[model samples]
Target: MCREPYPGRVTAPVFVLTPETVEPAGAAATAVAGDRLVLTGPEAHHAVAVRRLHPGERVDLVDGAGLRLVCEVTETAADGGRRERLAVRVVERVEEPQAGLQLVLVQALAKGGRDEQAVETATEVGADLVVPWMADRCVSVWRGVKAARGRQRWGAAAREAAKQARRARIPEVAELLTTAELAGWVRRVNDAGGLVLVLHEEATVPIGGVALPDTASSEAIDHPADEPRGGGKGPQDPVTIAVVVGPEGGISAAEVGALEQAGARTVRLGPHVLRTASAGPVALAVLAQRVGLWG
Candidate 1:
């Protein structure tokens, strides 16, 4: 299906698109908004032919860059028998408020596609960015062409998962990174006043006890950004928390030491150890709730 959740029971089915699909005044958002949009290509065909959605029905469209259009379907027909047409009349254009803190998942490469699974679940849980890590204990290796293909697959997975969750902002899928590179990311996030956490079975600190950005108010972040990646940094230095999860064999003591020296705090998710594919998502869910982004 091309559509997914819309918060409440009566909300329209939501679809995600790239910003390039709708540019200029066509996708231009405004406070008092009413516009016309045609959703063609796969999105239109899936809705029209597959789901059997029709005109006069309500739907929601998002560019995945923060613009969401609550619309009423107007047309569905064969365009010269060459294409399927699904049109909508905009009811309102709403921009979802950016989360005060950005969530990042740094998942280690694991065999049997478990790394991919980790990233997919993390995106659905509200991760703003996903990083594929080449850890010391990783069983899977992404070398040369494999690295490019791996990253591309991760990006596609994150997009599909985000759309399924009906998120307006799709989480970024970064290139496969080595432990040294992961350390650089830690420095970057910390410079921007965010915390980097490593989930270890041996850590003394618990996940819930970690420091978090204020959810009570939009208090400005005190940290200054030395290098800003996306919308996560500003005056608030927007907390860019990164949850690091190791591979099936688990993180090595040496790798743990390296990360801790680079500003990452070793933290435990629970008493029992989780699978490599399960650890990052579990930590992300816990942190999102601690920061009050979830109930």
Candidate 2:
């Protein structure tokens, strides 16, 4: 006979949701409804076998889309010879959107496995996008199957971390890029409404001093005496921001020059030297704070 709720007995509910199931529904719009959600794939397995959740039992269901659903298990199917099924009925749902500052971390690939840590931290800190930059100083080489596997692993980490943080949007992990490729990406993102900021200790200006180009500035209307004049629409829309970080050995002078030539403004995080893996997320958190993302 079991004594009344044995001392130190495990009571906190174990999750049935895993990275595989969570990733698909994480960003999908149709995966969840108000106070109701459906679980499939590995999530279904965890619910049935690992947790042994039964009908009428309450549980929390979090979709990586920033919706947290408090639900009750309404049906359960568990048999030794057959697959299991678990159904949940949502009791409540909460939705929280990402902050106004759409920060993207263009992180240089680092030696060892630090890139993964960077990805995980960026996801937790609410980075809207993570681009793996293969700078000249980057020591870890990624190609073909290794690159694919690494990306999958990073995606899984991001999904799990997003769920843990209860974020509404899953940050994207872009395919790896070389220095030249990264510059082109910067140009594309700039055209898409982002201001490019490259983090370099050599920069004299702090990020706080860098503001979006004001539409009303006289420069918007005045034609430079040295340039050919052409009619144009009003000042370009507010540029979105992309923050770039360097590798373990830090960015080279030539690479920095390239980024600057590509229209990226260099800014410093502070006086202390932060590892390549730490700088991107630190900058992101600062940007998030500046834009009132932190509650």
Candidate 3:
């Protein structure tokens, strides 16, 4: 039996809408108050046709952009025995504080279906960003239509996983990057006042021992030409850390060289080897906890 309290019956169906759809001036004029935010979409279909949700029920809705709402259904539409519109009254709307640490996982594409698992776990564990790295050892080749499909699949998985974990924020999945492009990204992030940490099985230092780069030091660092003009300050200053995880066969010597050249610090996670799919999230969990984002 589960020891945790049951969240209670969901009265309103929760759905994710584009930022434009959730804006006050947009399609649905649902008011926000406390912890409740209200909106309706295909998620309504899932609630009615799938879950058979009815009026007076409650459900949690998130914009996947760090907004969460708890709402109660006030009205439901029936069209030829099929559910259509769902109107809900917002009971509460709460904005979660940003995680102290912004961890971006630059994961090397892996063979098989491991890449999807990596993205799903990364989102659930609180990664702020996910970047697909096309490393030298990557066995998975994403091109043309496959690339488009992969991006869609990854984004959908992240959204679904975020809801499952009850997270207010959903991480962004960046377009795929080649080794050279990834190095440039590392440089750009570092120049933008973020610290980049590359996970290497052969590294001697434990990840826990790694401290966020001091704000003062980050400000003193030079910014790359393409980096944003502002030095680390406010939300941007406190050590933006990127965790780079290699593929199943691991990062190549050249790839490691490129990262190091881009000023990424190599850190080890643990004694044993973790699968390509697990390393990124496990590292993220540790970082999130150290930074007080997780208990």
State the lDDT at 162 in candidate 3.
Answer: 75
| True-structure lDDT of candidate 3 | 0.70
List model 1 lDDT by residue over 1-295, tens digit each.
Answer: 0112345623467676544444333454452356777777666666677767888898778766656787888887665453666778878776665555678999898898888898889988889788889998777899999999999989878877877777767777777889998887787777666788999888888988877744455432333223344334356545577889988888888888888888889998999989988889989889877776665
lDDT of 2 by residue, 1-295 (tens): 1111123312324243534454344432344443344466665676788777888787666544344455678887667543565667656554443332346788887777687888889888877667778889888878889888877877877776665554535666778888998887766655555577899888998877777532222111222222211111224322346789888888999988888887788998888878877888888887766654453
Best by lDDT: 1
lDDT scores in order: 0.74, 0.64, 0.70
Off by over 4 Å in 1: 1-11, 19-32, 78-82, 213-236
Give the local distance difference test score of model 2.
0.64
TM-score for each candidate, following the candidate numbering? 0.85, 0.72, 0.80
Candidate 2 TM-score versus the reference: 0.72
- Candidate 2 Cα errors over 4 Å, as ranges: 1-38, 46-70, 75-85, 92-101, 213-239
Candidate 3's TM-score reads 0.80
Model 2 lowest lDDT segment of ten = 1-10
Q: Predictions ranked by lDDT, top down?
A: 1, 3, 2
On the 0 to 100 scale, the lDDT of residue 70 in model 1 is 78
Compared with the true structure, model 1 gives a TM-score of 0.85
